[model samples]
Target: MDEEILVKKLKARDQKVFQDFVNEYKDKLFRLAMGFVHDSFLAEDIVQDVFVKLWQNIDSWELGNAKLSTWLYKVTVNHALNVVRSKKKTSNVVDISQFVRESDDGGIEIQIPDNEKNPHNKLENKELAGILRKAINTLPKKQRIAFVLRQYQNMSSKEIAEVMDLSVSNVDVIIHRAKKNLQKQILKLMK
Candidate 1:
């Protein structure tokens, strides 16, 4: 079924369709939540809470001129920012690009450390991922979202703009600044 039809069915209060919607998006939503919250347990809870909120507000929903996924992404990002902001200190950091697709099952999987590898190389790889994640975490909200959607989620600038409710030019600027900031941070780390 096409997404539009599925969404329409959901809007019409078809309970089965809602279940299908959940099945279709649960993994993607969980990944997105985990990307932002950087905690597996908390991210799972966040995804579930967001879905419950979506169901409760379904009756009031008016699917204006946006894709369902984009709307969902927007809601997810907002929820994540709220969660992070509520923290008094110690923001969460995540290495989103680590979740790469594997050929065996099409599952999102990061590279696992080889048991036979020397400790030093393993430690170095761990340090690199950490440094990269730190640089990404320090990005401003808009830039971070734009960069993550673009780089990690493989979303086009147009899709990111819709998800973020930003102009295409603004998205371009965010990407530019995000790359610049990441470069500067990487250089700082290397020094």
Candidate 2:
């Protein structure tokens, strides 16, 4: 079904709508949380908590003003941020030992694909995706959240500002810094 119909059903208090919503976005939400937490298990737990929060608050959710996906994105971002913050309080530096591991053949390669548009560039693109994911993990909390919402989640600056509870200019600044940081990290990794 179309997003509009699914959301309308949800707003109409359909019980099964929440299940459909979870099924539709669970993987994406989990990936998003993992982007921040960097631990698959913790990320999965966070995604579940986010959905529970959504289900509990669905009645008060104003599906009239925004797309359900947008709301979901906001919720996902906020939940991921909360996880990041809480973990920070309890653990200052999260270990990156999990994200980095040697392959049977060799170590990690950090390189950008030259011909990204080529149909046969899938392998190179996958390598580049890995490098990009690594680069994202090194970003600071605000920059990471801003970049993820803007780039991966396909959210505009205004929407990110709303999700992160920051001003539009703050979102813009964070994204700019994030891009610069990403570039520096990519270059450092390539060296």
Candidate 3:
């Protein structure tokens, strides 16, 4: 179903529409949440909470010049940030390495060059990917969100801006800074 139509139906409290909406966006939302929180269970809970909030506010949803997906992304980002803040407040430290495992089943796969026939290349790419992930983790929340949404999620700058509630130019600036920071971090790691 079209997003507008689905949203309208969603507002009407159509159970089938709700089911289809969840079926369609559940994984994407989960992946996006995981990208931020890096905890599978927490990501799932965050997405569930987002949908519940959406359901509760369906009637008041103003898709004004924004796509439903964009609104959903905004919601996901807000909730993910809240979870991160809550964790920090609770003095619980999260290990980045724990979320760096192989994404073979395709939940949060890092975009690394894969050469099955060449062990050397694969190893090199895997090492680079690890360094890249570390660098990404070191970025500020906004920069990290911009970089990951652009590079990992393949969202355009405009979409990222909408999802992040920033201007398009601001999104570009954030992405550029993120790249510069990542490059510096990777070079430092190489040293």
lDDT of each: 0.72, 0.71, 0.75
TM-score of each model, paired residue for residue: 0.70, 0.58, 0.68
Per-residue accuracy of model 3 over 17-38 as CA lDDT, tens digit each: 8988888889988888776666
lDDT of 2 by residue, 1-191 (tens): 87667656767778787787789899888877766666677878888888888777766765466666667777777777776666532222233333355666897643333575556466544444456556776799789889887766677899888777799999999999999998988766544
Summing lDDT over every window of 10 consecutive residues in candidate 2, give the lowest-scoring window. Answer: 89-98
Residue ranges of candidate 1 with Cα displaced over 4 Å: 2-8, 88-112, 115-133, 186-191
RMSD of each: 8.6, 8.3, 8.6
Error of 2 at 59 (Å): 1.1
Tell me the deviation in Å of residue 148 in model 3: 2.2
Q: Rank candidates by TM-score, best first.
A: 1, 3, 2
TM-score between candidate 1 and the true structure: 0.70
lDDT (0-100) at residue 39 of candidate 2?
65
Model 2 alpha-carbon miss at residue 16, Å: 3.5
